[model samples]
Target: MWTIMMILLISLLIALFEVPYLRKNAMKREMLVFFILLVVATGLGIAESLEANIPNPLDWITFVYKPFSDFILGTVE
Candidate 1:
C-alpha cells in the first residue's frame, strides 16, 4: 500500500517536472508515448506489489520457439 503510493508519488513528481517542457516545446507525440508507457509500467508495478501472477514475456518466446528447437534437434539426430 505504502509502496504503491510512494511509487505513484515518485511518478507524479517526475511527470510534473517533465511534462511542462514537453507541452511547451510542442512534443505532443512524444508526450503521448511517454504517458502511455508510464501508465503500463505503473500498472505492472502495482500488480507486482499485489503479488499478481504477471506473465513473463520470455514464456511466450519460449512457447513459440520450443517446437522449432525440437524439430531442429530431431533433424540433427
Candidate 2:
C-alpha cells in the first residue's frame, strides 16, 4: 500500500541522515535504543496486519479519563 511505502521512504530518509552520525560518534546506547524501538514497532505492525486483537494503551487512558470528562461536563452544564 501507498501508506506503507511512504512510511518506509520516510524512515529510510531519516536513517540516511541520522545513522552516519551515530556510527561516527560510536553511539552504542543510541543504536541499542533504536533497535529496541524497531523491534517493538515491527511486532505491533505484524499483529495489526494479522488482524489479531490487541489491547491498546489508548484504551486504558480513555478508561481512566472518561469518568473525569463526564464529571467535568456535568459540572459545566
The TM-score of candidate 1 is 0.87
Off by over 4 Å in 1: 24-26
**Number of clashes in every candidate structure?**
0, 0
Error of 1 at 59 (Å): 0.2
lDDT of 2 by residue, 1-77 (tens): 56555555666676678778888886799988876776577566666766789998999999999999999999999
RMSD of each: 1.4, 4.5
Q: Distance (Å) between predicted and true CA of 57, model 2?
A: 3.1
State the TM-score for model 2.
0.61
Q: Which parts of model 2 have CA positions greater than 4 angstroms off?
A: 1-21
All candidates: TM-score: 0.87, 0.61
Best by lDDT: 1
The 0-to-1 C-alpha lDDT of every candidate, in the order given, reads 0.91, 0.76
